[model samples]
Target: MNGNGTLIHLDNIYTAYEGAAFPVIRGITLSIRAGEYAIVGGPNGAGKTTLLESMNGMLRLTHGSATVCGLDVRRQGCEVRKRVGYVVQSFFFDPLTPFTTEQVVMMGRYGLLGCLRRPGEADYAAVDRAIRLLGLEDLRDRPIGTLSGGQQQKALIAQNLAKEPEILLLDEPFSNLDLCTRDFVSGVLKDLAKKGIAVVMVSHAFDGLPDGEIRIIVMRDGTLSLDETCRPDEVESRVRKASTVQ
Candidate 1:
């Protein structure tokens, strides 16, 4: 992809934990364009999570550079984070914390409103829209801790969308979901991409994607091994290839 007009650009990146013998990610480069839906797949310990973190500036690059939406993620970390909504592999909540589903979803707007400003009527409306969009109305007033795993994931996604971010990053979003919920969430992501939001998802499974323009990135041994446009038979072929390599 063209990095100049891309929403995300990583060039020759290297990242390592302090005092570690080997780098977690080494000399990786990739670009994702606006409105693109891409999936990163690999075996365990392939740096898929690390690459996603670099996109949002959560992990500092030891070398090379990363830019998101034309902003240098390292130099403009806060700004980059504001435009990207990240959903991690696990959703954790304190059992006693009293945040309702609506309240949790409304948190997405905090980045836009900033810490000093309070959520106004418009912000609340946006939260409502996001909740309705994600079909979370029945659970809107429920305590977050009481919801099921799928419901919690939907709430997390709703929270991210409420921010109206330019890009969405999901790491193993379907890991804990049933098949039905996985399909539903996958459709939601496809809808978001159609609305012009760039989406980069990390998944081991790449089945049932919408029939449209999409991209795939394969990661292995802390490097981006393959990046290409998605084709009809691509997923199965990649899966077979990855299986053989392992």
Candidate 2:
């Protein structure tokens, strides 16, 4: 709970997983404001994903404070999650899974609808807008599981958009996407940022970043090594310089 314009604020926080021996990240502090495009990069096991989860309130903090969208991450995790869209690192679906792309996207509205209530006109409108924004209109009725991995990834993003999140946390979202799709998705992210949606992404692929200033955060040994703003083209080099293993 700090900084009015800051969408995510973590102050001297320590996060650990269930039954873990010790904390994965410690004494962490960072602030991300709206309309910012941030790229988190580091060597493997450097707590990049952990930082994203911490911001999304998906992990338990053993110490310090984490606030997202003006709510306490520790005490108001559910509310925090509602305003933050988190696209995880890995996901796949069985080909026979029954839900269509549209149905899956509508699931984002479930949290807001509450118990025993169905999606109303406004909810459906939001879903439709999200689908169209992601260019998934052609795949709206297709079974989500039957789509290619890249298509499925795009659908996942559209699903999050349907929630109308103030901030988006994406972990290697382009891993399944090729160069062309990466460029298109990069444009989509840039547009979201321009519209005042904070985009925090963790990715090694840096060839398709947008043409603007990008905030680069680097992690090392579960600690923040660097935090700076540079041109989009400088992200990879800065990450390399800050990573411990490089």
Top candidate (lDDT): 2
lDDT of 2 at 57: 81
Native-to-model Cα distance after best TM-score fit, residue 135 in candidate 2, in Å? 1.0
lDDT of 1: 0.85
- Model 1: weakest 10-residue lDDT segment is 237-246
Error of 1 at 154 (Å): 0.6
Q: How close is every model to the real structure, measured as TM-score?
A: 0.93, 0.96
Per-candidate alpha-carbon RMSD to the true structure: 2.0, 1.4
Show the lowest summed lDDT stretch of 10 residues, model 2: 1-10
lDDT string, candidate 2, 12-122, tens digits: 999999999899998989899999999999889999999999887889999999878999999999998888998889998899999999999998888888889989999
Clashes of 2: 0
Q: What stretches of model 1 exceed 4 Å from their correct place? A: 1-5, 18-21, 242-246
